[model samples]
Target chain A: MKKLAILFMMVGILIVFPGVLQGQASLKELTLSERTIQDPMKSWTITFTQPINKGTLKKQNFLIKDDKKRQVKAKLSLSKDEKKVTITPESPYKKGVTYYLYIKGNVKSGSNAFLNEHTVLPFKIGAVPKESKNSSGKTTTNDKQPASSSGKTASSGSDSKSSSNASTSTSSKTPGKNLVKVQTKKHSHFDEISVQVSDYVTKVKAGSNEFEYKGNNLFVLYQPGLKSGEKITVKGYSMSGKVLETKEVVIP
Target chain B: MKKLKGIGVAFILLLSILMPALNQSVSAAAAPRIDHTSPAANEQNVPIDTDIRIYFNSDIRGISSQYIKLFEKSNGTYYDFPIKTVKKDGEALHILPEKSLGFNKEYMVQFNGPAVDLLNGTYNQHLSYTFQTNYIDFYELMVVNEGRLMNMLDTYAPRQIKAFAPKRYINEISVIHKKTGSLKGDQASFNGITNIDINTKSEDVVNVHVDIMKDGKSLQKGYASKVTGTKASKNQFTFDIGFSNIPDFYDVRVTVLNNAQQTIDSKIIKFAAEDGKAITSFKESYKYKTAGNGYTFHELLSKESLFADLLAESMMQDIKVQVEDR
Candidate 1:
């Protein structure tokens, strides 16, 4: 019975061996300079095992796609020897997004040999360290703070009188508990403000400028060409881009 | 008769000079008199923390604490203010109150008789002066640093003094961030504003002067034009001080000059542009003399300062490349 089982296993190995070799022969390994990018402005370098055909180095032969399957506009440059290709995005890639570099199978080497298999190389920009799944099966994070821009932009259209009253009323209560407080130091040509953020605030935005949350809850903002009595709108944001607090302070 | 007349004329001239000297000596030996007093008699809008300074014509010792008293008026009643300490510095008698005076209140300082001079000449005059405290203190010195350079200098978080590592081109960004356009024209290393809030409106002009110091030595001085007391509520005076291109530790002396160009309210702020070192010298600036340094920095090179240095270095490199290309 043991000899019969050994015979069946040998036959099974023989049946799978050719198919495994065929699968290996069809799949092409993609080569990339980096698999992960920390900078949104990072460029990828693709090296060919054999010298590539110069004519085959067309934009159509090489494609970069974001996670949404949308093609990213990129500029491609080939080395003089045609063995190295560099792909740089025209604009910065969004952080925490995955991108795929597709090299078409039609790409031919100098010897007129086809690449035989389409190669897809995946790279990620700014990886999110802690990720969890929500009820919708979508990846979500409560740990990582969103970048600066998502904080609510200050409304510039508020009535000066009402806003000034609002600001003046809140100015004295600036250092209250669990609240973001901003103190502005006004100059003739410029104004400097120090913001004391709440414990949960991750970023502070003053007018058009944005600053990361300090560990010590202090953020200083300096704006030039602001005369005294001018208004500056400061906003604090949480990790999920929620406006934690907003203070419209007149320059003093 | 001619000789006698000549002698009489000479004697008269001699006596004219002698008589004045004799009177001066007599007065000098008399009671101790106050030559000047800060927050002079009936002075309005005085700082709450102002020392009750009585400048004497001659050096005087500290009189009895009971004789030198401060009274604050409330509801038509004068209450004795708590005395912390009384100091006699050379020709000045400084009376420090235990607690800061209330805002917009009238206070009277009394030197009730027997103000003994250094030579023990006692003045029996009961001298007193009244001054009303200001509603808002104008000595708030706010140093404003801005632009890409400041952004680079402040890496981790924003702070009062933009500090940098010494000799690093990155640190200069903190001081010269206000310089826009070309580096050719007049550019200030640091720009600051001090508010002078007073109740009374006057045409008195306040001239501002900035003296830059390095290692305790005077490096250079920049002058700001006189800003006349324009409003009764607040007067914002700006100081545009130019620092040398060298990156090092510096002490910036910002002085508010009176009409006579004498230093009135002054502050000395220590700045560090070396080794990402933090500065502690800013506290020396008179807080009672002015408002405290706005938004004092605990550390110049926090995680934020590092961020500033890196950002500034990258930005400066880009600027340098752009300039070279131009």
Candidate 2:
């Protein structure tokens, strides 16, 4: 009985051996982090499924083509784990341009396996993508940031109200402005006031010291000697310099 | 005869000068008279812990403490009491008892002997200032005194000066908080008005000069005299200085001075952006002095109404805004 059982196990091993060898004969595929790189590409990377052999790794032959399909020079280097390939542009990418990147499957891995297929990647530099379309007509792919503008943007159309938030990571909306106490500080001759706001103040014209500022939710002003009510106007602006709201105050 | 007439005219001139000299000699011999007293003569309802001070016309060179004694009178008997100090002989005398005096009791700063000054000027007579020590008076801020000064205007709270209100010395000084752009739905309590209370305990320093300073620049200077002859003992020398028109954002300091006009205390009342070229000193041109009734800070606010507009124009500079990119 023991000899018969040994004979069956041997047959099972023989049947599975060819399957394992056939699987090892095929090569694993390579992937990229981002297929469509954004405009003004600083670098591009290719990742492998297994560790790569530094001695056997192909140093050159990676190609990048401009929109006209003209070849551009680029440098390629492997990551520390030998699983990543980084392509650095020797020169800066042109504005409003597109490029094509490719590497052949002849690249070998530590296991001596070749890439399953030729790698191809398409990227854009300071240009709109072929797959994406923008119809809002307010902002374009060209100008994401603009200079500060003045006066009201008289667009009362019921368009989607996109609130412009503060730009800084440390910046925060002045919460509870609706419940802020109109606190007053008294000096020898004048009073200092702290007024909370619902939004950020883009321009403050308190008394004669009118200027632009950032990250201010507390509106303060000096009432020189003291009299009946005065008018205070505060204009709220988006980071893009679009006036969102205007506030006026009457203090008696 | 004409020569004699000339001599007579010269003699007359000589006599005129001689008469003034004689009068000066006589006046110099007389005792120094009290020009100002902290507690006016025969003043009633003074704080029990009040410090007694007397200012004289001439400086007494050798006047000893023995000559100036504090006497507390009880029934028909009087007992000598210890005092703080006798400064400059007879120029000024400050008497601070170790503790408060008995309420409703009379006290006297008695001159035991003839008080004399330098240059043989004598204070010829025995003098004593008899005053009754009572409770200190609580000075109230007349914010809404029957339509006289109504700032709160039907608010939840009255604009009354507290016992700890900041002491404002200047008459008619108004502290105006620039309009807070608070919307109508803001249910939060808004106290844009500054209620300054000055605690005037007669037991401590008497009259003080309060200097309102922005940054290091003096914006206003005024004197705070201790309240006396009032029935209440909870008196605080307070000024509800309406913030009229200070430009937004300032480093405000309220300084307190002792009777000697030296800064005894200072506190930062408001903090804001410091002006490098701010008005270093409040223009003395706008100072208002009340002749009879004590000049109040509100009076000054009303006197220069145009200042509010100027300050409103200036406060226009203090709006600070923060915006973010969405």
Candidate 3:
């Protein structure tokens, strides 16, 4: 009986020790650039020190979860050099919410070497405030209403205070300037808003209704009952919930 | 008041967090110069309420109304226009007018001296630009390739210009030739031909003129054609334009002209190279070729083994002949 127990113990040790060794190897964390993001429309660009295997860029390897631990739907795109991966949320992240970007140990490098680290990067959106205040002291909240003619009241949140926020945020932006081109085309019964926005823009708002970025240089929004010669204001926001640009376009 | 204070604190905190990123991107050390302008020089059909913007190559201190002036031309005289705001945002200057500009009127902007630059002392270059406000709005102005070929060139190929106006205000279509991209060999000797088809739906006749522009100056002379005006929609008129090669990239500007000879709609169409061919097919055009001369050590050894086998076979035959003679 003692000899049999010794044999079982030896077998158990051989089975469990490799797993412990692997768990220790994968505990390594990668340093991130920005920990707190203000823009709800922000996309995270995570660059790896070594080239990644394209086949390993699967949902099991890359994931983003909100504070509720629910997986947030995001798009993973590998850079041409295979050393950078961009994580873009399908929808805007909720304000004042914390999200964790997880890179699993299953992810492999180009040389077939495992990352060996269950990397978790925690980032917060919109700082500590759940609601932002405008100049009139009215707390601004994200309006979840569908775009329509009756949605005018929802746009009041983007008043002078938000414009001031846009100006301040844009002043601190580095590198160069961002040009937002807005063109309003008057149709028979509706006005089509066509804007040329850069990749950095997370949301494009016309009047009060928000338009999805759609991962393109240009996006369009339709407003009903809009007349020719009428003017409309367009705004673009970054991932940090900060307004990057505001432009007034006339319907033509 | 408390909300404002909270916002101020948040703004300061955000600025503090973004300061490191801001410092890393700004590496300019040169004097600020005019990179470009919104209503470019001689640009036509500008929106009446369009904000006049001046983008700079580097950062500027601020925008000054004293250095920037706007004027409206009426009755052969220029009148000073009121500027409501002059703001320096980032690396650009934003100018807003008190009210919307007059329609179908010419406006001139003058940029005088003493704009403070971030690095250098001041940028005092005197520059002036002029633009004409649009009269009518065009719903769509498209340049379509009618030939169905990917890269069409010369007079045999017919391209179409479709203009959809809200009203019947379009009078004519103007084709302005502009050179782009690098040339193959000699810029002065290279040439090509292209045909344009104007498709309009106006009650008035629309004329077509191909004007050649050199070094930003209009030559004012080229091919011209007159087409019958039809009250019906989708009328087509085709004309040919012959041109010489200047640069590598080729683009032509098609404009819709009003009764006052002012451009109401304009579109720039870039010609694509067919089957990965060079943009300009000049006499001295060159093609790219890729060659591989790399071999692995195993391949080199295999090649050497074949030579060694041949030498050994020859030596064996000589030994066999010597043995037979013995």
What is the C-alpha lDDT profile of model 2 across B163-280, one tens digit per residue? Answer: 1112223232223232211112222112122223344333334454544443356544555444455633543343223332232233334445656665544433332211121111
CA error at residue B278 for candidate 3, angstroms: 82
lDDT of 1 at A88: 77
Residues B222-285 of candidate 1 have per-residue lDDT tens digits of: 7744334542224333333343222223445565555777543443433422111111111111
For model 3, residues B154-177, the per-residue Cα lDDT tens digits are 311211211111222222333332
- Candidate 2 local lDDT, A1-252, one digit each (tens): 999999999888879785755542353222211122333546655554445557645544356778898877877787788755667777877765767666555555565544434444444542221121122223222122111111011111223221110000111111111212344555434555555532222234444443312123445555555444665554433222433343455555
The 0-to-1 C-alpha lDDT of every candidate, in the order given, reads 0.49, 0.43, 0.48
Q: Model 2, residue A210: displacement in angstroms? A: 13
* All candidates: DockQ: 0.02, 0.04, 0.00
Candidate 3: CAPRI quality band: incorrect
Between candidates 2 and 3, the DockQ winner: 2
Instruction: Order the candidates by TM-score, highest first.
Output: 1, 2, 3
The docking category that best describes candidate 2 is: incorrect
Estimate, for each residue in A1-252, the C-alpha lDDT of model 3 and write its tens digit.
999999999889878786755653545453221244556766666555456679988976778898899999999898898866777889988866878777666666666655434555566653222343332446544331111110000011213211000000011112111224777665432455778754334456765555522223455665555567777777765433445556678877
Interface root mean square deviation per prediction: 24.3, 20.1, 28.3
Report how far off residue A169 is in candidate 2 (Å). Answer: 14
